[model samples]
Target chain A: MTLLKNIWEWDKRNFERLRRFQLPHRFKQIGFALFLVAFLALLAFRFVNNDATVIKTSLKYILLIGLLIISVSKEKIEDERIVQLRQQSYQVAFVVGVLYSILILPLVNYMADVIFKKESLGFEVNSWEVLFIMLLMQWFIFRMMRKKCS
Target chain B: MKNTLKVERAILNLTQDELAKEIGVSRQTINSIETNRYVPSTVLALKLSELFKKPVNDFFTLEEND
Candidate 1:
């Protein structure tokens, strides 16, 4: 029991330490700039050479990394309340993102199949797309909650 | 939980922004606490108590639902 208690304490201490792991506030702007540039590059690549799957995949990963930087960066005022909101936003976004993948995407695919009067195209949602959705949703919900609280 | 933070701040003639600055928090945090939309952590509650020069219980009290 003492050994188990020690392990629990160590885990808790590490978790608390993780709470302080955030980039400085300026990284938020830099992250957004990176995301924007990668997004435009991806669009231009799609227009120019849609067959370059490797390059497209690489750009998508860069976009995901940019979003991750933004998500993990501190706000201008890194208060406890903002931290709480960020946690809440992440939780909500994960649930919503899963529901979107399981329910909304399939529903849309079915609707498209019916409307187009074509056979099912077996549309698959990419993992990167889901991550993008979750991050965007988290940001939107966090901003809305902040605005309402303010 | 409910708190008399707004009333206490008013008595001291301190705006939300000023109180937040004193506590090293955002103005929105003060607003959230005043509006009863957020319950501060023990550290924050202690900070407020220290700032107001009162016991934590003087400003913060438990509701029956809490």
Candidate 2:
């Protein structure tokens, strides 16, 4: 019982410490701007230098990092309800992201192969893509839930 | 959980926004709690109790479903 209690206390303390590290509300806007610039740059680069895989990958990472910043930033009103909704959104997004990567993507690849009458096109879902999907889903669900609650 | 937050606020003639400001929460949070869409944490409950000069039990009650 004492060990369990100590562990609970440690967990609670770390959770509070993590909360303190959240970025201010204004960071969300900065994150959005970064994401937009990276996305547009990626598109322009793709047209200009189609074979620039390294630069394209770097741009994608920048976009994902921007999203991560947005996800970690605090809301204007960072109350208990908002925290709860954020946690719920993360949970839902994780489950959906895993399912999409493991099931939906594979199924779509299979369908495409059958339609084209070709061998496996070596289509694979990367971790970055899964992270992007999860972040997008989290943002969408969080906004929807906030709207509903309001 | 069911709460008499709406009733207490009404009795105090306080708008949701006003009460929310007093409790350091967003207006939507007060609205959600009153509408049964959200259950506040104990800290928030105690803050409300303190502000309203009532025991937590007076304003909050557990529903059978809860």
Candidate 3:
């Protein structure tokens, strides 16, 4: 039992140490700005060139890359409080995303029924949109929690 | 949980930045602790205790609700 406790303590310490190698706060800030600009530019281009298949194909990738950079960005102080907030954010994102998806099932069905005026409109929710929503939600929640916690 | 971090820092004549640098954390972390907005981890609490030359309990105390 003592040996097991010691091993657990050692592992916990190692895990905490590993959390310190996050991107520098300034780098994260710059990345956030750059990615936001790139994403918005791509989005505007897609709007202007609505029929461009290449734009349509690349939009999701751009959004994903932007979201990834934003999510990985560290706060000004990457302390234990911020780490706790990050964990909370991921948990909140997953649970809320699943619930939101479930709720959207009926929403899509209703939209198909009313708007399309067809028995089976065959509407599909874009998987990329779901992922984007999840990441956005996590980032928002993490920011709020970090502010509240710290 | 509540802490006497501000008082302890005063006793040692250490600024928040200095204490934070000594412990390898940002100054905002020390400010948060001083303001009772954030709780330090066990490792951090121990480090603070070591720096202050006192027991951890001397700086931090559990409230009734805790």
Candidate 4:
């Protein structure tokens, strides 16, 4: 019985360590994910020397799809605090997305005029900006409203 | 977030998860309510009160903003 109790306590400690879902846990996962992306991006940039456009574009598209999948987890949100945070986050993201569009509009037109020589889908790189803004807004709302609800 | 949930659960000695199952919510939701993380809607408040064998007012009290 004593041995069993000690084993149970050890197992509980292990579980807690593995399943730590606080802010630092989420941040660590995100940091690791970003590092993986940067490593892959560097590899893609280095390896495909010839016919750069085809391979680089494909790599960018892959990253685009990956980012979309990660951000699309918005569909699975279930917590009320998270939902409340999302509501305010969306409000800010909308404003920030619009502002981002405005800031990039001139650059986009210039890129079209000088580089691509016409309108193109280069603006899709705004995915990270949108995700960042959304997360920032969510955090802001969570911080602002968390106390009130409590 | 203020609720007569403590009184209701106390009468039966039902755990938060058991009460949540009875009301068709996740345990986290019941915990949230008990800890004042979220306030239930009028319908849900009424349901809880009914389950607790109490009046809605007895189960839920309103503050100025809430």
Candidate 5:
């Protein structure tokens, strides 16, 4: 129980003025953990079935969104170290995502033209990877703006 | 912004929590204002002055540069 409480406290974080977000955070975390376990299970049984691949892809997105929601609840963080870590981690994610997207465009082209010699196939830019990039970018921008304004 | 909040609260013998509950804000907000970490909005400033039975200017000041 003490260990579990420690994890929950870390995840929910401290609110500067109020602890209003704690209840919703606990529920979000439960859902997030469930999604993560299912996602990992799907990964473990990858060779079991073809349908599992499709299910995994979709579940990946749902898991990403759930984690994003839990991570971005605006709980009014007060600890300076946590704030700095969050700011830097988000910046790194955003930079990597943008670089990956830029590289993917050219890399995918090269793969279709020179490497695989297959017909060009466009993918859904709204896929989980793209959504992850966007969420990271959002976090970076939010933290930067918060730092500048308040 | 300049404020005489600590002075007024001291006169009224109101603890930060009591003042916060009376003003519908959290104790942290009161603490922030008292420590000059944050400035309250106009409505909140007025409410606090009214609660202390003082003129708004008694609690707030407008610097010439502000």
Candidate 6:
């Protein structure tokens, strides 16, 4: 019983450690460079080939991964102010994202009817688009607010 | 809230980086507090108090707007 208890405590500590873990500054910098290059390369390929299928499949994955790296990476000095800004970013991103999701359906319908001239409207929105937009908003707002605050 | 953190640090002859190290926070945090751009938490306030050998109220006080 004591051994089991010790194991549980150790596992709990490890879980907490993992929960608070962040990548080193150098690794994050390298990740930023690599992802930027990959994104530009993919974009150029899409522009040249004009392949809708390939672009639809691979572009989003690179975007999602790059956004994840941006969000997860730590600053040179991750202090209380930065943490507060992060909280603000999350709150703003969530509210904006939900509002966008609500408004986008009607906008999409309008676009389909007027722009696309489609008779049959089966409006299905992609979830990744919303996620990407939310991530972009978070990044933009966080940077802007941080700049104003600091 | 308003604080005399810059004055206190000056009295102690401590740089922002040194004070931040003693307080287990980043230098930018100390700078922010000094510039009145950010407020420290209760625990951080107490830590500053302990480091400066002064009461929390001596370092921080409420302004009319606060």
Model number with the top DockQ: 1
Highest TM-score: give the candidate number.
Answer: 2
lDDT of 5 by residue, B1-66 (tens): 777888999999989889987977666667767766566777788888789988888888877778
- Colliding pairs, model 2: none
lDDT winner, 3 or 4: 3
| Ranking 2 against 3 by lDDT, winner | 2
Please give the ranking of all candidate structures by DockQ, highest first, separated by commas. 1, 2, 6, 3, 4, 5
Per-prediction DockQ scores?
A: 0.80, 0.74, 0.46, 0.12, 0.04, 0.58
TM-score-sorted candidate list, best first: 2, 1, 6, 3, 4, 5
User: lDDT tens string, model 2, A1-150?
Assistant: 999999999999999998678999999999999899998998899679568888788899999989988899999989999999999999999999999998988888899889997788455888888999999999889999999987
For each candidate in turn, the interface RMSD (Å) is 1.0, 0.7, 2.1, 4.1, 8.5, 1.6
* Quality class of the docking in candidate 6, CAPRI style: medium
- The candidate with the higher DockQ, 1 or 4, is 1
Inter-residue clash pairs, candidate 5: none
What fraction of native interface contacts does model 5 preserve? 0.00
| Docking quality (DockQ) of candidate 3 | 0.46
What TM-score, computed on C-alpha atoms, does each candidate reach? 0.86, 0.88, 0.76, 0.49, 0.48, 0.80
| Model 2 Cα shift for residue A108 (angstroms) | 0.8
TM-score of chain A of each: 0.83, 0.84, 0.71, 0.41, 0.51, 0.79
Q: What would the per-residue lDDT of candidate 4 be over residues A50-94, giving only the tens digit for each residue?
A: 666665666555554444333324322245445555466567667
Report the C-alpha lDDT of model 6 over A57-127, residue by residue, as the tens digit: 67667767777678778878787778888889989998888877778765777787898787745455578
lDDT of each: 0.89, 0.91, 0.80, 0.62, 0.66, 0.82
Chain A TM-score for candidate 6 is 0.79
5 or 6, which is superior by DockQ? 6
Residue range B1-66, candidate 6, lDDT tens digits: 889999999999999999999988888788888899899989899999999999999989999988
TM-score of 4: 0.49
Stretches of model 2 off by over 4 angstroms after superposition: A1-16, A46-49, A121-123
